[model samples]
Target: MPRPLENLRVVDFTHALAGPYATNVLAQLGAEVIKVESPHGDLFRAYGDDRELAKLGMGIPFVGSNAGKKSVSLDLKKEEAREIVRKLIAESDIVVENMRPGTIKRLGFSYEVCKELRPDIIYCSISGYGQEGPMRDYPAIDNVVQATSGMMMVSGSEEDPPIRVGVPAADTYTATMAALAILAATTQRARFGTGQFIDVAMMDASLIFMYGSTAQYAATGAEHKRTGNMGFSGQPTSGLFRCSDGHLVSLGVVQHNQWVTFCKAAKREDLLEDPRFNTIYDRIDNAPALVEIIEQLFLTKTGEEWERQLSLGGVPCGMIRTVSEAMELEQVKQRNLRVPLNIPGMPNADLGVLGTGFLFAEDGPAVDGPPPFLSENGEEILSMLGYSNQQIADFLASGILQPSKKPETAK
Candidate 1:
């Protein structure tokens, strides 16, 4: 099967989550992605609390987003290393970097430089703010961007301290959007024979995720309040409820039909005739009383039983599940959400990571191979650029290609 981006080559100069995630998407779609790292490798390789893995320079976070790409360590601070990168960019279709604004330019591979090398190169820059903004140079990570973008304010209850999302939503979404932009640019290049620069800001992407709330605030001139586990529609039945087993179930009875179905399923058909609960708006207005009654009824059954009955009765509901439980779900297996990776030097040969979000009928997204060790393909990449074995050795000796010091057991 011929993948969509099979012919494309990408020079990836990204670290941490956001930039790597975008390149990962490209790699999954069959682009030949060469990930350029510094002599110390990507800082993400030291992220997380697993000290043992961090020592080996392969943190879980790094492995999660870096699969299916070749790694080549080069000290961009050196002129010789910069020359190597220029050569790599000249031969590639796209270049993606997530450094702070002006960092890549200082290293001498800005959009203008790349365009001079490759006439139709797609250069993407991912940053905290943007290239030309007041906060362009500010250092930001997922949590900081989440707070600055009003995401934390809307995440938890109003009484709770501003809670950051458990997952790096800002970084992940920004990466996804970057991939989309890059793909769009690729299409444009094909059509017009020209390349362009893409500036994707994590702050902008975070705001996109909050578009619904933003729209509401714009129209009503009132701020949207934090309502934990409650649907934004203010539906009385669309929230979490505790069952007899003390476990919780999320019920999403947003539509009138679902509300009526829920009422019948819980043997509370009298709710349909009650004036305060007659219409969706009426139910919203009397949500407190309605929720109290529903909670009492829900406490009569276990969460699993309520899930079974409500789901069968056409009401949208599911039992709250832990991360482990969710991963082990039958649906997850059926959808092929988890994929096996055989990373070199890792203790586990068959490590599981997430698969692409969606599938294609032909030539779909797939993890071509495991994540590379730091500079794992340094020699191979240099050779592809027409360097002789002696030249490759000299480059390695000059600290231009810093390969990983693999454990004896891995060798």
Candidate 2:
């Protein structure tokens, strides 16, 4: 069985979370991704707090997103090094860069330059704002984008300060969007025999992730309200509640029948006849009283017990578990969301990484190899591009290329 992107080559000039994550998805889908790094390395290679890992440029953050790819370090300031990039792009199917807008152009590998090298290339540029906008020149990272995209504003309660999401939501979502755009461009090129230049802005992608809220505001001129620990459905029945076992359970009793079913599950069906809590409108109007009664009812059982009871009784609900706890579940193990990952010089470590979200029936997404050390595959890549051994050695000797720095200690 062959993976979807098998034999396709990508010239990756991206680094950090968003760009590398996009290429990581392509690598999982079986593309031969050639990660072009500076003579130093990607900034993210030293991003994590682990001293040993960062020393070897194999930080957890870097390894998490860079598996199944080849690495080649070249200082593009040198004309010879830039020529090498041109040659690689000439033979590659796609080119991806996440440098601040115009930075790649200054390096002379803009889409126009890439088009001359490979006319049908799919060039994707991921940036903080966009290729051409008032704020295009401004730099941005996940936190900055989150704050600027109105995401933080909708996260916390009215009394609380805006809360930044725990994870890099903007970067994560933008990566997925970039991957989708690249694949769409690939399909379009196959049909029309033309290339595409895709510009993905983190701010734009962040807003798109909150499309429903934005759309509602656009349509009704009503701003979204932040309801802490409460579900977006706006029903009093749908929210988080603490149970007797000191665990929290999230309930999804949005519909009228679900509310009724929940009351029945708790053997409190008398609430259905209560005028103040009978209809959805009445429940909304009398939310304080209704929530107080429901909270007391949930306190009678453990979170797990309530989950099983409500779920079996046709109400959507689940216990809120920590990430580690959730990972321990049988369902998580069976889903194959997490795959074994082995990085160079870390053979004894028990490492696992996530693949793409979706799976195929056969030849599905998978990591073909471990994450590369800096310039780990430079010689091989150069050879594949028709460079002789002597030429590769010369490039290495002249500081045009940086050799990989594999860790000496195996653990």
Candidate 3:
């Protein structure tokens, strides 16, 4: 009946998306993740509320990344709060943080501090860059990282300036990587009885994604230009086509033989025989004409029809479904991807669009807790640590264990 990470305790000092995301994955697999937050709380709660106290707990991002964890509000600047966090560390097996490079050490609670408290502690730091890179100190968001890592430059249409992805992809990807690394390190610790400090960089993950084109461009001295919907593999027929219903389907005829199947499916056998569309290079050169032809052909059917044909023919293709559609798909439903999350005191709490990406494939307990109210458990937590009610009341009065209250109450 035990989960993969049953009984393991985690001290989560992460916010926004990346660091919290990693620990949330651990929480899903049965670790106890205590999320320590500043007094005002993670900035994302305001992302939905626009700074009003009534709007404080509205966290679309926070809900997605922080489900199945306990939230504790503590101003680490205060010595009282820091001491409480130290107590939590004494009972924790993992500690995750996503502050700027030196913020934790400056707060007087570095990896060394945690290691001294718990020798087998696994400490993870997820930042824009690794802890010691020349660019480590620079604060970065997902779009900024994309631009700096050259992902934006190669991600757009040829006619437009570099465009950041519509989603915070770098943050999400790096967070997934961080989770994998933490799991790997935890696995190693089972044998060695030693844990390590893991440093994950968002920019580094972006660069790795661009490695293929970046490496080719480096050796060839040629810049890789954007080809709109055209994929980088130089597939002549790999582009999005609009159906009569105003929907799109990504058709990738990457293989020469797939091209024949695609042409036959589209009822365009003459294009196959046409010398202008014979080879991959020729198809790339004649993509404009090819697109025109395909567009005209696609207008005769709907996106659903093309998806069926493409799927049946074993051609590489995907229908451009909306987020709702994607969420409702059979595969997604089967995977239990859209987990129902109910946070405490929220009207309707559901925290998962970009849920845990590190799937184990084995049937197991998923992350299953409502996001905690800020410092809601402080008194209980301290009591569990042997602090009496009077000690807890003193800490509460001093604002050491700050807990959020109803909107009409004090600040």
Candidate 4:
């Protein structure tokens, strides 16, 4: 089948999550993504290992953003390597890099140079604070960005300390958003003969996630706080309640009629006539008593029992499942959320490699082959550039060409 963007070429200079994540999405969409790395490889190859698990390049994090792409190793510090990158840009449709603001420019591959070579090129720069900002040079990570943007302040319980999210939510999300912008730019260029640069800031993305709170704070100086299991503004019938099986279930259908319907469905008809909980604001004023009412009624039924009941009655509610439970969910698994791909080149050669985390139209890309051994494609790539075996040997001997060194985990 002919895939979208199948003819497009992308040069990826990003490392870790932010840059590689964006490039990974492009690769899944059928772009020819060339993942350029240093000789030592992306730092992510070594991430997430502790004393016991530290046998080799675990490559867990690296695998997430590097699937469905070809890798090439080049040291940009060398002028010869810089020329290689420039030549690559001249042939590529898009370039994605996540370096400090001036790093690429110093390497002589600035946006202007890139556009000069390919006027219709879409160039995206992912950074901590964005270019042209006061703190553009400052360092950033997910936790610090969340704290600076007051995201953690609004997560978890109000009484508990600010907590970072369990996942790389900010980095991964920002990567998606940046990729969206790059695609948009590409579309605009194709349609109108124009291309431009895109700058994405993780902090800015975090702030956008909490725009409503930031707007309210700007207008009235009120801070949004952490409310454990309770909806903001203390709305009744909009929180987690305990089920008979000792599981937590959330109910977020806040419409007044839904409240009435929920009470009937839960067999708590007496609450309809109760004066203290008659109106929305009235219930808000008496949240504690109303919560106590819902909690007691909810505990009468098991989690699955209440789920079916609420779903049938059109009341938004469900269980507070852990990651394992969610992965094993019937509907989720049926949707192929956790589709398995075999580790390429492992002893079990019958299994193929898994490409990307997402699917398009139906299933994600069928990897078609195992993850290539490091430098497995080096000879082929050089030959494609019209280099003979003798020249290729010279480049390799001069350290101008690097075949891949399999990370420890590859063995």
Order the candidates by TM-score, highest first: 2, 1, 4, 3
Top-TM-score candidate index: 2
**Which lDDT tens digits does candidate 4 get at residues 178-237?**
888988988898899997899999887877767767777888998777776777756768
Model 1 ranges off by over 4 Å: 218-220, 404-408
How do the predictions measure up, each by TM-score? 0.96, 0.97, 0.89, 0.90
Greater lDDT among 1 and 2 belongs to 2
Reference-based TM-score, model 3: 0.89
User: TM-score of the candidate numbered 4?
Assistant: 0.90
Per-model tally of clashing residue pairs? 0, 0, 2, 1
Candidate 3 minimal-lDDT segment of 10 residues: 402-411
lDDT of 3 by residue, 150-170 (tens): 888777688989888888888
Q: What order do candidates take by lDDT, descending?
A: 2, 1, 3, 4
Cα lDDT, all candidates? 0.89, 0.90, 0.80, 0.75
lDDT of 3 at 406: 31
Residues 62-130 of candidate 2 have per-residue lDDT tens digits of 989998899999988899999988899999999999999999999999999999999999999999999
Q: Number of the top candidate by lDDT?
A: 2
